[model samples]
Target: MDNANTWFDYIPFNSRGKVGKISVLLLLIAVGLSDFVSASILKPYFERLRPSHSELEGLILLVNKGGKYGFVSSHAANIFAASTILSFFYIHKKKLCLTIAFLVSYSRIYVGVHFPGDVIFGGMLGYLIAIITITFYSKFVLNKNKKKLIG
Candidate 1:
């Protein structure tokens, strides 16, 4: 449980079958890549300025200054993507994960780096990407009966 330890200890390797594990792993990868694409591509495309970059009158800077553009918050997208992926496997903890995602997204706005709309859009982008990933994962990756995955 030490922070210094590697992340392999956290993967649910034993409980899930081979395909299930593969699905989870791929889900993680896809969500991560999706968030990266959103940040790398969409931010520059939108050309929205961060509050720090803009000379606002009363903007309280909580965190350090970020890059030039900040249309969609990358932090929000990444965290929400993780929450969505986790929610697929852990139905019981959906609300908790969502709340955590919401709070994390809100932090971006609270930090004055991104607007409320930016965080909201980032969260939606993550969710939509996750939804697409899970749909493909469910249809192709999971086995018959639609409940579990088998190798």
Candidate 2:
């Protein structure tokens, strides 16, 4: 197949237009912020121990123990943030994005790294961050530059 005008020609997937490129950049920023909040701020403040570190009688850790704290799983936060932002940009792939985020969050628990509450809170935090970021993008970035992007 001729690859001259393929969709992947841009820096990001399907980002042929300025809006798409901006969306991708915002998505990345959202995910990064989510992970930072979960891993650096909240986790340190809460200081909850990972299941792998706790002495659960029957706990069988699939992976090595994680850091000192696990109040919020960064993996869950990052994935959910990415998924939520992607859903905003690609409405048709919302289900797929959410499913992937759910699976990744669940794995954090299944592997005995995070508790159910950790994953839940992480997902919520991620969703909140994504929403805030997307709203900012829509209001400031997209709205302000609508004419430039469209024209």
Candidate 3:
């Protein structure tokens, strides 16, 4: 497998269905925005610090240290949002996306970038945002033309 392809391999950009394509794009954007809001807004509001910066000791980092605030991890939020949105579109792809999401969230904790609470809250925020995005898309785009790919 090519190294660059590794980053591009998972997303099914050329997949069939208009709704599926639009859903992926919109959901991705929503998740990205959600991550931004959580990282920038909520993190400042919560005023949390990363485990590495805090009083914690003896951490083994698989990756580089992360930003200051660890509450509501952006990785967890974005991945979960992508996973949830993809799951809604293609039932067969649900397990893969969700499994990846969980792994990504766990990796944050393992790398000492976030606590379990941070990962969980971030995932929750992402999931909620995805739900709202899907509902809005369904109401405005899907139902506007009375099209059905999935609910």
Candidate 4:
């Protein structure tokens, strides 16, 4: 348990390193863009309502933002996407990245604004997208510049 807690503790300070800080910033930007595109634009088009506003009234009403249509959670999507990209870049600190990701995703539920299912699905989707994006960028873009950096 102590070992587990240690990893979580490291997450908040992982960006202390110059390279790690740069990686974190890049991941944050990528995640933010993805979340904005999905939640702000896509959700409106889909027009799905929140669980609380749905016909089923028995569910827990976490938050009542007045405006319904809470299909995908922006918080979940952003945090999970950031986590995925950070994990790929900082493979040595994968556990810390995952822990931070989980906490960020959970915040949406704790604060209201998104249903449990919405967060889960959004997180999964964001993670998948991040993985593909990171993999391709690393292979094509970074690989081409590796020699310059090393030399």
lDDT of each: 0.78, 0.86, 0.83, 0.73
Please give the range of 10 consecutive residues that has the lowest summed lDDT in model 2. Answer: 4-13
Output the worst ten-in-a-row residue range by lDDT, candidate 4. 8-17
Better of 1 and 4 by TM-score: 1
Error at 7, model 4, angstroms: 15
Off by over 4 Å in 1: 1-20, 143-151
Tens-digit lDDT string for candidate 2 (64-97): 8889799888998899889998888778878988
Candidate 3 C-alpha error for residue 66, in Å: 1.5
Model 3, 46-71: lDDT tens per residue?
Answer: 98888877886677767777777888
Better of 3 and 4 by lDDT: 3
Question: Model 1, range 25-73, lDDT digits (tens) per residue?
Answer: 8667756776787778999899999888988998789889888888888
Q: Could you list the CA RMSD of all candidates, in the order they appear? A: 3.8, 4.7, 3.3, 4.9
Pairs clashing within candidate 1 = none
Model 4, residue 34: displacement in angstroms? 1.8
* TM-scores for candidates 1 onward, in order: 0.80, 0.86, 0.87, 0.70
lDDT of 3 at 31: 85
Write down the lDDT that model 3 would get. Answer: 0.83
Scored against the true structure, residue 120 in model 2 reaches a CA lDDT of 94
Order of candidates by lDDT, top first?
A: 2, 3, 1, 4
Q: Candidate 4: give the clashing pairs.
A: 48-69, 49-69
Report the Cα lDDT for candidate 2. 0.86
